[model samples]
Target chain A: MGKLKLAVGVAGALAVGVASLSALAAENIRIGLIEPLSGPIAAIGSEALDNFNHAADRVNARGGVLGGRKLEIIGLDNAMKAEKTTEQLKKAVDMGLSYVIQGVGSNHALNIIKFLDKHNKRNPGKEIVFLNHSAVTTAFTNELCSFWHFRFDANVDMKVAALVTQISRDPGVEKLYLLNQNYAYGKSFQAAANKLLKERATDVELVGDELIVPFGKVLDFTPYIAKIKASGADTVLTGNWGPDLHRFVKGAVDSGLGATFYTVYGGIPSSIGGYGDAGKKVNLKQVTEMHENQDGLPEDLRDYMKSYIEAYESTWYPDRYRWLIEQLAAAIDAAGTADPIPVAGKLEGMTFPGPLGEVKMRADDHQMQMPLVVSTLTSDVPKHLIYKGKDFGIGFKTDGVVERADTTLPTSCQMDRPG
Target chain B: MEVFAFSLFNGILYGMLLFMLASGLTLIFSMMGVLNFAHASFFMLGAYLAYQISAYVGFWPGLVVAPLIVGVIGAAVERWGLRPVHKFGHVAELLFTFGLAFVIEEVVQLIWGKVPMPYDIPASMNFAAFSWQGLDYSAYRLFMLVISVAIFAALFLFIAKTRIGLIIQAALTQPNIVSALGHDVPRIFMWTFGFGCALAGLAGVIGGNVLGTEPAMAITLGPIVFVVIVIGGLGSLWGALVAALFIGIVDNLAISYDLSFYPLFAVFGVERDVTGIMQDLVRLTTASIAPVLPYFLLVLILIVRPRGLFGTRDV
Candidate 1:
């Protein structure tokens, strides 16, 4: 009789211990970050991840979300491959992480959305939500849209619309040349530029529209530069990223091609070094969300930038990931649960204050509407703290900013929502 | 006419650089029946080492010291890495070098982040060397041309005239006989491999800034080096030279022109509502197809002459 009583007491104690451990686990929410942590573009992923972690720290410091439940980020290296990304997504699901963030490649984004849709259909109550901080392909929020996928960054059409507005304002750009990589993103960029140029800047002649090289294949761009010079193009508009952008700018400088490079990715690190002193002499412009030394930025953003630079030793770009997490936290709080379906529903058409100003996640499409800033690289240094170019060891000075009101383009998305 | 002249000049300069890289690989492959797949990786190492060294002691000293450092690394790789793999045969040796290439790239990324290093032309050489038809040619490119030509002449004399060169030549033909003559054949092999890598290092020292020294530099230039060797008649130095120049010039000329197939189709009087894959083919231009020219040439050459243009033996 005494032995039976002791056994009952031990069993009751074990049940209590398990229940308390689970409650402790429930106090924290895990968000998975799938990115290329290793490979050729690891630096890009590392910087983005650093920004994500910094954003998480800031959120947690501000008492987190859903009444102080701390947020934890789980990063998995997908190596920028689709197969590896799917595998990591599965792992994230198995770990009970309902929210996953991915950026970088649109191909990977499209694959993840398809994978998630299929997985959610099979698993019912275990549906996962995908938050895209970058990868601006239109199809993600357009024809290929999913109920579970939400993109925080502007799509290609929106960026093109903003870029065209900037280009039209400059009367010096009479002849424009379009050079881009031959891929989905590049094709979209070309198509949008063509349509937008015709609509907005009809006076500007399209001198050359060439998609001559594959991504990351062209080492020498002298031939291309020669063509541009021969065409007498006053402005060269390109959407090429990575080494392609750097090499093209370098070739232009080397060949003395006297054209303003109005590019989407001209401000990335090491690109300024490619221009050398030529950048100071040439017209180099880029479209971004935020830059250092903007006169009227909010105090909170300034403080955030200071802390981020102090920790990472690099300047932080206005990443949508920060705003996405804040918005996600607010949505979770509104829903009063960590379950993805309800939280995702709450996230639709959500409005939150971002670094630049107020940002809204469109209900029609899951695309975020935020401000775009058009800036130029000048010889002058910024008055405020800034991220210096790693290669050139010089800070980028901005010339202008286009507010969200002026840059946001109307979305053509007709989303098919999940009942 | 100006564009044609400029393209030709640029092509010749580019070809000479390719020759400098390929000459070493051809000699190494002939000497030790092992194709060093990591040859371009050593080239990349040379560039990165030069960049680091240049930060402390100016560019001129970096040029000298960096190649020597690469040579030592190459010799060590031969003694420790390649020598052991030789017993397992050529495939094992090739795979070993292939894996070494990846390891070197990862190490480069770890030491220097993935961004392109600020390996620019020295300030003194930044000005234009000359002007042709109102176009300014960079002084540094001219300097690169002179260095490549000088190295070629020096390498030619060293291999054709020196006593060590004669021994190396003999060993290429009869390794066992040369070893029997009180010569340490393995040490000679190690020295030859190191010398070959040093040549590649020299190419990198010059080519790095022009080509942009990043982690992907090895993979970018690796295949072209192999193509040069194969087309030049794998074991022959002169053959490699001719092939490299040919490829470089042809590639440049192809890129310089933008001839569309649509015009060709019109000339042939085959004008119909082109659709599907046919339409895509019709829209193709010379500039779009230029990157593949060298590979196309390689295939054609292989089919026509399996031994290559100047090859004395089968590759």
Candidate 2:
């Protein structure tokens, strides 16, 4: 009986000690990283998780944030559903986390924006700011713009502009056909292509434009390829990803459509590897911040790529995500507090030196104005970079970089700031 | 002329793939009076097994060995799993297979993970069989076409001409008579089910690279296989073949042609632009509706001809 009482006393003492340790650890600021971590596109979320963890480690190594308080990243899975996103945000709010980060889909981002707009309005002291790293729908910064929302990645308009610039560069690209998936992003891509093509390349004829059912629905793209062939278009522009892109491109190439494809995501992850020699036939170009074969890389960049490739077995696609963390940490440091309002103030109209070059956050819309690159898949990358896409012996060659100023466009945001 | 030729050619190729998959389902349903809901899962299993085997012994060996392994598995499933549930009515048997499908999918995920395997066309077959105009038709697809045709021919001969085939046909109507003649009836049922699954596994062996070998590959192709079998008249081989070709060609032709509803609306003579919500629906061309064409045809066939094109029993 005496021994049992002593044991109970020791266990209570241990529990209290652990509780006090957690109280000390509670001084760290938490950023809820809400993403689709458990669905068909779970890899996208998990990849971002790795990059976010790396970014956090880099910050913590640099003497942490907010005068020695560490930046803690809390991962929350939304299962790629828009309705579930608010639930995750509410969970984050329940934990008293004042900052949340999300990327992957525009629908999820919009949900966060709507939920937070009401939550921040209703609850005065407990406001959470959303840091968007990759969802690039343009309206988020324009029509449905929120004061608390800051986008770190370039928008659809910016990417479309970059693609159009690539089209302008190639004098051979006379006839253009826009075939995309029939969805909001696809429609937006078509609109941007039409509007931008008319302005920039008046010589390029818009031959045909159609939208098919989005991914997994279309098992065969040969009929669509025939339609393109019949159009006599020299270039095909599509924003197709996943199986949709791979199959469409394969059909076009194999059937001898003889048209160059300018795409949004052509050579991105788990894609085009199965294309075999069909990948080599067409001039497939994609628009992004960076590719493996970008010329004149620094030693730091090369080592970083090597380490990332070794660790993840995937090409590091989202550089803007890293920048998002840097900018957030910088904002917190400058504000001298982890308060969402003050940090958001510091983040808006911020300019920082990213790895590639200087990128800015426009005060008017809180959209990142970063330079975009239009690259083509080629076998002529540097030897070190050859290991990246060695399966297909093809990687993106930097064709041209649309400057930050060129990529920037006017926004129509009318944010109602708190007095 | 070239556009029509290409679409027709591609349509026939797709139809052949469907026939390859559906013929097995037809055989199993005809012989056993059981619809194997987990048939497509066997296809997926074959692909993953082939992929794993190919990594060790090369593609050609994997192609031969994987389907055989799948046949063994199918036989085991019939003997162990299905035989016990055979005493139950059709609905109970169906529920068993339905549950089996989910279990198989989970097991595949547990083993292979939920990503697409890097199973691709063999290097020897990766080149274009021929190039016409500017496009290169893959040699692998032609190989697939040849294998599909061969499978149909072999299955037809084995079922129609062979002595075992005669016994099996007789047993379909007179299981007691066939058993009285000293033939083991349950063993024949087991073999037929195994052979049926083997055909599906073979289809996977060839179709995996084309359709993509992933966990969702089964589910994606699952509904379409039913559409084929249903429209073909369930348990009718010839009917399945014809229906598959019909669906494949119609789907291809719909996508190939850019016909719109504007002309359809013009015939009414009270012509006005479709506005508001109707605008998007009106603008939807044949290409946009191609995805649901097969299902639409299935519904049409069910409403118009419930027995299917050549089905003996009403679906």
Off by over 4 Å in 1: A1-26, A273-282, A383-393, A403-406, A410-412, B263-276
Q: Which residue pairs clash within candidate 2?
A: A254-B136, A255-B135, A256-B134, A256-B135
Model 2: per-residue Cα lDDT at residue A367: 94
Model 1 C-alpha RMSD vs. true structure (Å) is 2.9
lDDT of 2 at A277: 52
Per-residue error for B34 in candidate 1, Å, reads 2.2
Which candidate tops TM-score?
A: 1
**Tens-digit lDDT string for candidate 1 (A217-265):** 6757867787787788989998887667877776677767778888887
True contacts kept of 1: 0.41
On residues B1-315, what C-alpha lDDT tens digit does candidate 1 reach at each position? 877888887678778878877877887886676788998998989888888887788789888998899898889999998988877988999999999999988998898877677676676787877765445678887888788788767777878889888888888779889999988888998999998888788888888877778767788789888899989888777788889888778767887777777887877775556787676677788787776677888898899997788988887
Give the TM-scores of the predictions, in the order they appear. Answer: 0.93, 0.90
After TM-score superposition, the amount by which residue B146's alpha carbon in candidate 1 deviates from its true location, in angstroms, is: 1.4
Model 2, range A352-405, lDDT digits (tens) per residue? 775556889998899998888888877767532222334556677787888887
